[model samples]
Target: MLRPILFIFVLFFFKYTYGQNEIYELRVYEMEFFKPANILHDYFEKALIPALNREGVNNVGAFEESGETLPKKIYLLISYQNMQAHQDVTDALKNDTQFKLDAQTYWETPSEKTPFKRIESIFIRSVSGFPNLDKPADDSEFFELRIYESHNEDALRRKVKMFNDSEFAIFNDVGLNTVFFGENISGNQMPCLTYLLAFKNKEEHEKAWSKFGPHPEWQRIVKLEEYKNAMNDISRIFLKPLTYSQL
Candidate 1:
């Protein structure tokens, strides 16, 4: 009730506090493996990594989703606190001789077609008030956050059934505010599944978890032998809006 009002108030207050500059960070999704993921990984390590720093790019790292659990097993996180600052690299790319050469070898290789095979990018704006809302689901959570790094196609279908059971069971039994849940979609380098929680704000995210954790129903679910190993590695990150985000 009060949260929506607060979000609006904060949006306006924070908007002008920085003098109309809105910040956003792009979560670049590099989907599909480049024939040989190892080679592409090496290219990023050798070329893209140093180039980003030399070009004054902010934060860059890759999160490998557990291929054993999901078909989509890669997640890469790139950060930019200010959008206008983007020109620093684009400008450098125009003038940097060494960077240009590295770029050509890394990206424009004759045999290498392209880094991204198919891209499903999503622009996520921070919910001003919820800071750590990105964490995995709690007992009282109306939603479920399950990520999978699959090894084969058959397991993907199995993973889907497991997810539906978990999320649906939570909602039906717990009376929690489970509204929406979906995989984080993108043109990703490593394929993995990601789910977001829709809480009122940061406070409720905490409250829901604390209550959910000890609930008898939740404890029972957690102890189910069938659900013993659902995720390989579940990592969550928060993105602050860069100065360039339109919303």
Candidate 2:
């Protein structure tokens, strides 16, 4: 009993000191050509989201590409309080009788009739500077998801530090509203950091970015020696929230 008490105390101290950073799961579903998207939508709206909310997870985000493309993509973002919460919630779902019943239609659907051809999942940990996901404004209809890939682990570390030390404030000054910023913990991109920005529309998106390039703070930080060569590549995708999206 003493050992268990000590262990619990250590865990509590760790979380309290570290600001309780959240874990984000980003799931991308690539839809089949002829399959209806509504099947997955129904499952998410009527079953998955509700079950997750009951389990104390809320503000789930569902989105799609701003433009139509082959093999349509559906993006889902779920946030967990911590690593332990993520594991516990996942295990609890397996034994959730109501969740099982609600998900019956999805479970009974034939393989060939399934909505997606494949599902890709990426897990991320919130950055120290940005410890939680923020819901976008009511008028925020456009979002940009950006991934910065570094040449190596050290470079990735520097890039993340750059964001923490100066870039986040610069972004705020320039009116580039942030939704979330995180380091990819498990995904295809090994040495990368990902972040999302929200805007009212395309024009607002363009306008906000226009300020970032010429801002005095940005100009000064971009020339900082420590951050030089911190990133080698960037991938940007524009997304729009689905009708049922919570963020």
Candidate 3:
């Protein structure tokens, strides 16, 4: 009888732990044309990513903007099981011997001569509707990172509710392949939410979005009074995965 009770407790603990929402750190490296990004790429491909994997983080995505633009930027997505897990990884990296050795080159570089001018990190937490980052099964060539900024906290809450209550289902029906959805807990834009979508190509992206606006369910819910003014601004960026990117 004691053994059975212990087994039940273990089972319950496993379910609760695995069902918890995730935390994500989106790091953006802003680079100037004068500096080459090879060192930065090398550190990620050779040192940082591998170190994170050893520490039990998986599916780390490294990407660059799809088109050439001034001040080129690289995007890195790192997911943690939870806030505590994220803190643990951070503390562990400091004492990771192999990680230090591999990152020696980057560490030795002069600040003024480094590959990137600055780094911006955005912290996010998974929403109820999307509790984990979903790696695409298909070979996705194009990616979209979108952010919706709300006018206030209440508006942001409503927008998140719309996603949980209806928008996510509509996205599935319209063929919008989502990678993740989270609310920004700490970042440049307050009261904002961010999400990523993957597609086979630009044509597929256009096709999928074309279906979303006219979908009957979307048309109906979008007009609901509760959701009005839920978002005041939207920002989007197109990205392509680097050769070593896991996502």
Candidate 4:
């Protein structure tokens, strides 16, 4: 009888621990030019990503601007099982011996040889409606990162409500492959939210947006009084994943 009771407790404990939503950290490395891109590439591909994987983090994505955008930037998207996992993985990586050795060259570079001008990090909590980051299918080659800024806190809440109440479902029906939707809890941007979407290529991206515009559900929601003008500004960047990107 005691054995059966203990087994049941173990089952409940595992379920409770593994069933929680995820958190995400998006890191942007800004470079003046391509001079340091090689070093940045080596660090991410050879050291950082592998270290994170050893800590049980997966689906890490490394990307760069697709076109001739000035002031080249690299984006890294990392997902954690929970907020605590984020902290734990970060702490674990710092002490990883192999990672330290692999990243030595990049770290020991002279001040003048730094790889990036500055790095920006954003911490976000996944929206309740889409609480886990989805890994794109192998064929996905393009990712669109979008930031929606609102006029105020109320406006941001309404915009997020729009997504939770109806927008995400519409996206699925319209063939948009959404990876994650996160509210920026702490970041350079205030009163904003960011999301990532994947596509097969440029053509697929254009086609998806075309379909989304006229979708009946979206048409109806756009006319809703509460959601009107919820977004005040928008910024978009197109990215292509690195060859070693896990996403």
lDDT of 3: 0.93
Full-model lDDT for every candidate:
0.45, 0.91, 0.93, 0.90
Q: What lDDT score goes with residue 247 in model 2? A: 90
Clash numbers, per candidate:
32, 0, 0, 0
List, residue by residue over 154-217, the lDDT tens digit for candidate 3: 9999999999999999999988999989999999999899999999999999999999999999
Native-structure RMSD, model 3:
1.9
TM-score of each: 0.41, 0.93, 0.94, 0.92
lDDT measured at residue 45 in model 2 versus the true structure, 0 to 100: 91
CA-only RMSD, every prediction:
13.6, 2.7, 1.9, 2.5
lDDT of 1 by residue, 1-247 (tens): 9999999999897764543322323344455543545545565566665676676553453444322442333443343333454545557667877766765655655454544454444422222222212222322222233345554434443444455655445543443443223333332422444444434445665666666667666677667765555445655533222222111
- Candidate order, TM-score descending: 3, 2, 4, 1
Q: Where does candidate 4 clash, by residue pair?
A: none
Pairwise lDDT winner, candidates 2 and 3 = 3
lDDT by residue (35-60, candidate 4, tens digit) is 64787789999999999999999999
Residue 236 deviation, candidate 4, in Å?
Answer: 0.6
The candidate with the higher TM-score, 1 or 3, is 3
Model 2 agreement with the true structure over 30-136: per-residue lDDT tens digits: 99998888889999998998889899999899999999777789999999988888898999999999999999999999998998999999999999988888988
TM-score for candidate 4, residues paired by index: 0.92
lDDT for position 152 in model 4: 89
